[model samples]
Target: MQDPLPQIVDSHCHLDFDDLAADLPDVVARATAAGVTRMVTICTRLRNAAHVRAIAETHGPVFWAAGTHPMSVADEPMATLDELEKLARHPKFVGIGETGLDYHYTAETKALQQDSLRLHIEAARRTGLPLIIHARDADDDMARILTEEYRAGPYSCVMHCFSSSAELARAALDLGFYLSMSGIAAFPKSAELRAIFAAAPLERILLETDSPYLAPPPHRGKRNEPAYTAHTARVGAEVFGLDYADFAAATSTNFDRLFWKAAAWAKAA
Candidate 1:
């Protein structure tokens, strides 16, 4: 029998990482059982691109994006426009980066991170794929660079696992980019973050796990997987004052819009 639960999409996750990769089959199964029909597993290091792409190839429900993560920018060889565009050639390759500034920890590599981010932005622009951003403690530069880059030439993007300030939220939203709700938004102390999401238009909202990281309540402090996206979605529904099904449908639609390649791949499949 089909799942009676509403369909959900985990717009960002790290299934390539050891935490979930060790038991990926069961993880994917649990996500399916929980009404998560699709997931985009992010490749944070270009060196791991093949392994990440293989997971997407083998899993019917999985799609992927690749880039050098800001935190890893100094360590990894900087990603190039050609390499990112080449990766996008794969049918299930749907987005760019899990990339952006991460000043909280990697502040020393800020210059290199900015350079890598611009390369990814160019790749996103060239490939017509959504740029998946990860911002932390550098909202001013993020807002500035994104606005500057967008003005240079418009490109689609989503602030993945967004927990930034209202100003940054407004910056992204004003540029017509989406803000993804992650497990962090469901945390009890995240009322301010929830309010940032609440003030945004529902159509501009997406959902994610960023799993192997921020698991929502009940599972907080435990390892997260795609299945827990539903938990975060429920929180999103409450913030938006919509029923679960409606919120799920809206986010699924938002995912389709932002990750059109994945949506198209599903249709072809």
Candidate 2:
């Protein structure tokens, strides 16, 4: 029997992206059908914040974050903190970013990535919104930047789709940030990651799909969606040796506490 999806939440998603937009209602239905109660559609570029907001306004059990992604940030180099702050103040906006260093995909230099990260960090501090960070192949710099940024702003954040070293995890935890596990954690070679999860504090752990991207095993090498979060959660539950109901409850609670400022709005809906 499938475990009851007691309180599953997709702390990060990208429903506003075009591939999923055409079937928004259907996707929402699929998410609900799968017992995925809530999802925060991420804002990759500031230019798309309106699209993200539109989805939030029109959909129940959906929310949006307001900030540009690091890889996409250099394209809009002039995206100022004032601009991010303005969009961030919207009731529909919960988090400040999916922004950080990414040395894996493009040839973009570290300087550019850090510049964008700093912008989102400032926005998070100014608005008290949680930050959603993405780091790959640059964990050291990502952690160092977060350390420097936190010294100034002390904002809450989550290391989204965490697939980095134990040291990077430790650094983020020390800075009072939550760590998000995505479908990637279910991979066969992710044994070290599983070990980290075994030792991770449940209170500081969040679960996500990073959907349309990292499809968890049993569905890997295919397009992913929010509904698949259940699979990832199961993998996490098994890896951590916790009951599914208990694990889901803890993850939802972690999300609620970290983004407590948005809790009222999420509840009022």
Candidate 3:
């Protein structure tokens, strides 16, 4: 008989997004079949929180997080601290954001994004949930703000889909934050990024798909899903010089550690 695939977690995805929502059942099923036993669906806009929460409520293996994405700060209403704290009340709500500065495309709204990011950080602090960051092209400010806030009061965080500089990675790691590996890390040209991960402590690493986007090779240029987490994870195994099973277990344990609510929920189940 064949051995069972090692269990892993897709620590970030967007199941409520149209690309995946249109066939959510099958997407989740494929993830399960591929040994991706858990997923965290992120709500990028506050207005879509219901839909995102619904996806988690309906899917046994799914959990969720909500925040205003930095790029969308201009379009969406600023997410208030009270609002994020209320969302954290949900039984399956596991984290505070896919939030942080994204000056790459939205540099024009940097001021508002900064304000919003701080608000989300406050929520993460008050709620005792991990802050899920999505930084891009705003490393200096990102690093500064994160350090400033941590000084004020510490909060756990994960740099979701981390593809930033080694300096920023060091800044986060120095603060004792987790760095999540996404499909970007599996790309042929992501050698530098992989090296960054390899240099970081294995205990601080996690895996994600960032799905409906950045599908790893073989599925590159195609829509990504939770199942593709295994692809990036295989690459993570290679980067860390461990067998796939060891890598999967380590990342999943990291996920459970950083996402304690999800871990508690699983234990209760």
Candidate-wise lDDT, in order = 0.96, 0.85, 0.96
How accurate locally is residue 152 in candidate 3, as Cα lDDT from 0 to 100? Answer: 99
Worst 10 residues of 2 by lDDT: 70-79
Estimate the Cα RMSD of every predicted model relative to the unseen true structure: 1.1, 1.8, 0.7
- Residue pairs clashing in model 3 are none
Task: For candidate 2, write residues 158-253 as lDDT tens digits.
Answer: 999998999999999999899998998988888899888777888899999998788998989987889889898998889778888888888888
Q: What is the lDDT of residue 250 in candidate 1?
A: 97
**lDDT of predicted model 2:** 0.85
For residues 119-237, could you state the per-residue lDDT of candidate 1 as single tens digits?
99999999999999999999999999999999999999999999999999999999999999999999999999999999999999999999999999989999999999999999999
Clashes of each: 0, 0, 0
Arranged by TM-score, best first: 3, 1, 2
lDDT score of residue 184 within candidate 3: 97
* lDDT-superior candidate, 2 or 3: 3
